[model samples]
Target: MRRLSFAIATLLAATAMAPLAIARGPDGPAAPSAPVDKIVDEGTNRSEVMRVAQYLTDVIGARLTNSPGMRQAEDWTQAKFREWGLTNVHKEGFEFGRGWSAKNAGVKMIAPRPLTLIAAPLAWTPGTNGPITGQVVLAPMADEAALDQYKGKLKGKIVLLTEPTDITDATDPDFRRYGDADLDKADTFQLQNGGASANRRPSSASRMAFTAKRDAFLKAEGAIAYATMSSRNGKLVHGQNSQFQVGATPPLPGFEIAAEDYRRLTRLAKMGAAPSLELNSEVSYDDSDTKAYNILADIPGTDAKAGYVMAGAHMDSWAMGDGAADNAAGVSMVMEAARIIKASGIKTKRAIRFALWSGEEQGLLGSMAYVENHVASRPVDPALTGTNRYMNWSKAFPIKPGADHSKLAAYFNLDNGSGKIRGIYTQGNTAVVPIFREWLAPFNSMGATKVATGRTGSTDHVFFDAVGIPAFQFIQDPLDYGSNVHHTDVDTFDHLKPDDMRQGAIILATFLVNAANAPEPLPRLPLASEPKASDGFYAAPGAH
Candidate 1:
């Protein structure tokens, strides 16, 4: 999953609760169908979910989109889908940027008491040809305005990117499951008084522009390399870099150092010790294909006119860890669901499609491209290029539905972690609450209970929900994902729980079958329209 702010994490929408008690199906309170029992048996007794995760994470390694690893993952997933008797298995290509991976990276202090530091190269950034030795400088460059202050002062220096701050103790446990109180809190509806775009920070466009300009300045000033402090207190490093487009690649080698090591370097530099450091970043770029592909396969339905239901997960991850808890878990569950359905010989009226999206870490690029190509689209401003287009797309007007707009019954996403299914965020689609409750009843004993009216963002489901499709992300146990493993060096296969994976697969398979054969398509939230200005002090008379 992409990183999210507190606002996006707790984002909520209004709900019309009139339909909460009544199921939409013509038959009252639909129970788990006979197919669900078969799905559970297959997913529980004959599950291969752990093996799938092992192959994807342990074998494939980190799948940076369009890189060699990602290409291998796309091909392997399609092969697996075909091997399981899924029909129409293929890869759908989308315009993405250059792919990059770190071959090797190291940083160590050479002067003022030698010490080795934990670090990794920032993704999509250039690599030093070999080891580069230079004196460290605490430049603390934040934005373009600070560039003028360091003019002609950074020559042959390893610049520390941000000011070091004292680390604080964590307030909450690193690993946790949803307790009854937590689920009850989630079930309560939190009313949103204003528009979603209320209090905002600088746009991503401005950030990207500043990053490109800053990199150019650094290179022109003869800086040898740059290092940034890790966000967490532990020796955790997340090699996150977003300048991945063809023309916008970063100009200088970048590394993320462990927080404690970075602070020590900062202290040394502050005391005028003039610490010297040796840096080496061995990396490569793959420009062989500018396009990334999303792996897709389908189970054909009996009726041609009936629409399709889908399950999806991103198959891309950061360069650091094996990408296990972040998304390989989700991918494994999605694959296991498909295998279970096929193996159980369950038939449905509507087709079921399983999708493995790529370029998700960068910004829901693959899924958004798929939505634009086959689901729905709105006119985007030509000036909004790269990530900006996706960041600001929900504000676009006059959404135009594609031929498959209505044909898509629903899309369910799984990307939180290797956590078990706790519940689901309904995104305030009131009409589906009762139906979902019915669908979730079978898993009550497995701890999948709550059906919240709140919403969450920063995943592949955002675009589908924005375009008025019935899309949702399940609420999963955190289980050290947010605290210790998410995008960190420890996000490996060891953190995955086999029982959680099996539970998720069973629930996913059951939900897909229910939606596929439902009497009617699942309800959709209204299509987006331009929202009223949140802070209306300078508003136009009729701007809405």
Candidate 2:
């Protein structure tokens, strides 16, 4: 299993970053007080976070964006919010090209050896032509010349292009939680520059050149399909696609087999047995129904004139798994926090809003759309952006009237995993250090004691943080999130711990209440040093 990178990158002004992201402060810098004991005790005693998590992951299954499951999950969320007394429950839509979902799929070894196989097709790829039979080929397609060598040779062939999974020894405990030392290590990380090569796409440049070569070769050779091995063990499938652009060419049918089964085919072909296989798949893009969704619910405040505090988690997930730890856990956590506070009868000066976002897996699409619609905007900042950057950065629009940018006091987000919350990421606004330290004080006994000054990325909070509002993501135990759960078929209800879920609910609810009743809004970063517009959700092919 690959190790998780705990280090955060240096803050950039384009995304509303404040220098290094953290420091230590001994006392409150005027943080308002809350009835933490009452909220914490009530939240800890009777919580349904896990129950809701189970319902979403086990019952509703994967909520892939714009899919039937996602649509149903949206309706379910609104129903639950209304059931929980959250008023003004509704859905907001955004325009995107299309949605993709996986249906029935199958693969098997039929000749030279007859056996059923554990495998799945990559999402958004073309499906097989009804279990077409083909001879297997171990075509590396190593370079442009190699791809040419396979010309006409791959006709009616099943091309194997990937290696078996890395079944390494457990150097570290996969099931264990984080220790104090781990938190200390993450807390003290230096904010490093996002170098020219810092965040380039995996296997970029050469990857694109070779991919274009291979795609052309496959199309010319009339290959049956492309098959690779799953990256994780036990037939857990993992895949992602970026060809959602309008008029993108139809991708060739692509499939992934279990690591062990993959090596079996490789061994047979290498030994000259020339095994043959069968594949059948069904998939389609929802181009006609391509509007994305973001679920919203408001707990109306008594002081109608006061600002509001917001919290949310993305509800979308990879279609292969139940999306238990990667996000359903987060979705339920936010829902339960709202329920806990409402049930605890914790009233505040500011309103609290709960959001369940979609299109997060497809490059923060839903959250960025939300920011464009509500909390964030691109006001004229002469110090940051020049004339050219303004026209090109389509996402950098100024906050519009009645968008409620001013009323938004703070936004808290959770999307790490099922681990217990250990602390908060200051996101480089050190003034909040003292305030968060105060908010987290109530949960010290529950093992959520630290408040780190690191910048965590690739989530919804960045959408809010991009506009200079106070936003944060909590630090949690890693567990097997990186190795086994994330984007894997094993991301199911079993990975979530009820105790951990309850603890997270208690801590975040208290934080929400404290923020809602705070004497002043959380301090904001004086816009970033020089805003240059975002590079994008993911680094471009030429970024390296």
Candidate 3:
């Protein structure tokens, strides 16, 4: 394994740019830093990172929470950790709802003219057994009043829940660029109605209601299945446009049909031609609730009693695509970083933990559980009284606190995309900005200059930060992720950039090494005394 050469050059260049008091060669005063050999070495290679990423994305495919693929991913990751000589390699499991997986799916139109349709089953959706044809109906339950109109009417029909979007060539240049203003404006643009009521976009609440009603109608009126048109043109894009069925019963077989086919069906239905079709699928769940597992591995520090530093990335992904860009890249990057550190054989003062979290797509559930159960100094059942048997056991033996980290150092996270890490987000922890600048200095030649003071949401790091842990998430170039690969069928192994991943791994590994060896831990902000729950975090408009 060959470490990144660019990283070394970048660090030297950054050192030249900054004015520092250092000793002259052999006989001068001691330099301000430790030897470079102790920071990084030539063992971290790009080939290995790419190989691991390929295995995860191309071999395992989509890893939706507790799906079979997710289990495979967990096993594979644990094996890799052990191979890397990491300690404390194990799976920390927690109970979650049983999730559904699709083996195969297909859609087609046999009416007026034959045409095959591109379709995918929504997560946790029930599948139709074999093929059954039915008339397609334009059922836009727009509002409560509109829903009332269809109280007992949709029976044995395919309901099209989405509205049609007016096709136009209006593209915003500002939106094409990456910046805060562009993001803000892009969000605002999504909320604007394009002059139609029945074509109004649906919200999360509306989608939930629609799912419930569709399922109820299917059960009562004997409907064969349900279908919705993909809103983003006729492209076979990927994303979970369905509701999260935690402990609820599975709904009727449902899928998102191609936009073109849906348009044809809607037009025919409007002309009283009653568009009908058949649907069939196979969906089942394991007997146990879906178990969310966090892959925990650590590189032991030379000082057995030193505090710990950590780096992480979510291992779970949306059910639609292979999840290459949305998170597989991040997972691979962090894992590669750890491998690099271990291969370099650098001894540090603080232990470094690498966590690959599951259930990130389902509201950061995995990280939240870990923090609540293992990070906080609280018991699971706080209601038990002192006289209770569960409590008396503590008197027999002192009840120790959870993973105490008043000595905890810092946590680094990467999840933006497959792009090279551009900089670090302090997440309002301004006191640590100068330290990150020093850490990032070594990567300036790799195009990682910007150091913004903004805060970011929608990733696993939020869990640690909420509980007073000094955590940070890196910033990266967009790299067509949002528009092309993110949560889309195009999110495959090919979308990943090996050079980018290599650069990220080296930078991350070097930073962790430096942080671990630093004389003092990175500065911390006032403890996050008020931790916000993940519920409703992404509920606001334009929230990811």
Candidate 4:
């Protein structure tokens, strides 16, 4: 009976120490770098990203950089950060030109037949005052050479920059959910010593100059407006307007007319008939403003001395329709991730910076500026402008890493689409492969289990990766973004799947929190050895 009593006392002692053992996760990173249960449960259960998205896309309207709507979005996001108890909430400024917004420009055919063509104004293009009539003229001035023939002849005329769209038969499905094979292909990665196959991506200054000269000559000729057909078919009217730079004069009105209408106009011009149309696309330009900003907020870490983890998405988007799918989804992702972390009161070793960048649609202008101001500064590579120059180019300027460059643990981006978190792109940082694999472990059921080295482009992450920082863009399902929705009027809230966005927000929150609590900082690729993201795409798999 005395031995049994002793045993009971020992059992009680063991039970008394159990809470300490339970505090540490089994076989997990030291401490709760990113407490999976806390992140996932709170992330998915209380998702605020989509609500932010609805306000940005549905309520505030399209957030074209420098536009009033974009300003409104900035105010709203900052207020949200303040309300969420995030500290260091403010804006950072950079030299920028003017902002532009559009009401609606009425463009329709009035001659050779009364046909109304659906039209959308490009961003910076000024509106044609009142109803201006001009006969359609086929002016394929691709360069200055083509402009010689039309000198003084294009006065008061609508010019078609190129021919009508060549409608190809739709072969593949519009929407796609990537399968295992596709993910496997994307997972493979290796850095080539030289370069890979060329894809005609050179942006030569001479070529640009020639094109610029042509535009100058066209403007000098007093053209009423410019019109072009969509590069892809099915009434997809792709357009851009912000050609006016800081000191440059205002842009001429332009229209991305329906492909069918462009074809009709060209056909009539080919025949003896004359085709005419009315154009009015006025834009609100912010001539007085010389600078723009990115919204910045932070959740102070318990260990402030350990540096920080950063996450951001561009707030600026194409003026066409609402910029929902192209980026409103992404902006919401990071913002929502920040919200989740702050709301859950997740403790971390590192602070988290949530950034909402502007002027992303304008060639990563906002992010690049931010990098120059805060992260690193390098001379502009004229060759880098060319699609062909994306490879085989060395740093043109010495990099002056910013004070915060070393302290920046990593930057994560989300800009693909409203698809669920399928995978991640390591940008050839194999060291991160295993790390991401671990981060994605709990998300396997959500189908975010893959972490590949493939590279996807044309987003703000390029700015981060360009500076030798370990920046990444998630590998999201296509969801017709490339084929149809991106940069089109159809890219609206309708295309977003809430469940997918919610899943993405939750996943992002976990990643951010984990990065903040990581025992070691992420490894960086030497600036010299790191190749362009384009090269990462074209290089043969496993061809180091």
Using TM-score, give the best candidate's number.
1
lDDT of 2: 0.75
lDDT of 1 by residue, 1-544 (tens): 2232222122111111112222346556553353555676677667889889999898998998888889899989999999999999999998888988888889999999788999889999998999999998998878777889999999999999889999997899988998988877777665433445622534888888788888889899999899999999889999888878886668789999999999999999999999999999889988878998999999988888998999999999999899999899999999999999999998888999999999888879889989999999889886665578777777677799999999999999999998989899998788889888977876776788889888888999999988899999999998999998989888999999888888888889988988888878898878777666664457679876
The candidates, ranked best first by TM-score, are 1, 4, 2, 3
Off by over 4 Å in 1: 1-34, 190-201, 534-544
Model 4 lDDT at residue 193: 40
Candidate 1 to native Cα RMSD, angstroms:
6.8
lDDT of 3 by residue, 115-201 (tens): 677777777776677776777777775544566566566777777767655556636331132555533332221211221321233
Provide the lowest-lDDT 10-residue window in model 1.
8-17
Which candidate do you rate higher for TM-score, 1 or 4? 1
- Candidate 4: lDDT of 521? 79
**What are the per-residue Cα lDDT tens digits for candidate 2 across 138-175?**
88765677776666788888999774444766576667
In model 2, which runs have C-alpha deviations exceeding 4 angstroms?
A: 1-32, 141-146, 163-167, 192-213, 245-251, 377-403, 529-544
Candidate 4: segments with Cα more than 4 A from true spot: 1-29, 192-201, 204-208, 381-394, 529-544
lDDT (10s digit) by residue, model 4, range 1-544: 1122232233334434433111122356354446555555555556687788899889987877778888898889999999989999998876666777776677878887787786787667677767788998998866666777887788888888885656678898889999999899987776544333222345544554565576677789988778877666677765665464655554467788877778878989989698888787665677777567799999988886899988888987777768888889998888888888888888888899998888777667678777877888776554343222323223434667897788888889999889988989998888788778877766676778789987766777876786788899888988888888898878788888777777788788878877887777787888643335464346678876
Which candidate leads in lDDT?
1
What TM-score number comes out for model 1?
0.92
Task: Assess every candidate by TM-score.
Answer: 0.92, 0.83, 0.81, 0.87
Identify the runs in model 3 with alpha carbons over 4 angstroms from their true place: 1-47, 168-210, 239-247, 377-402, 529-544
Worst 10 residues of 3 by lDDT: 386-395
* Candidates in order: C-alpha RMSD to true structure: 6.8, 9.2, 9.1, 8.8
User: Between the candidate structures 2 and 4, which one is better when assessed by lDDT?
Assistant: 4
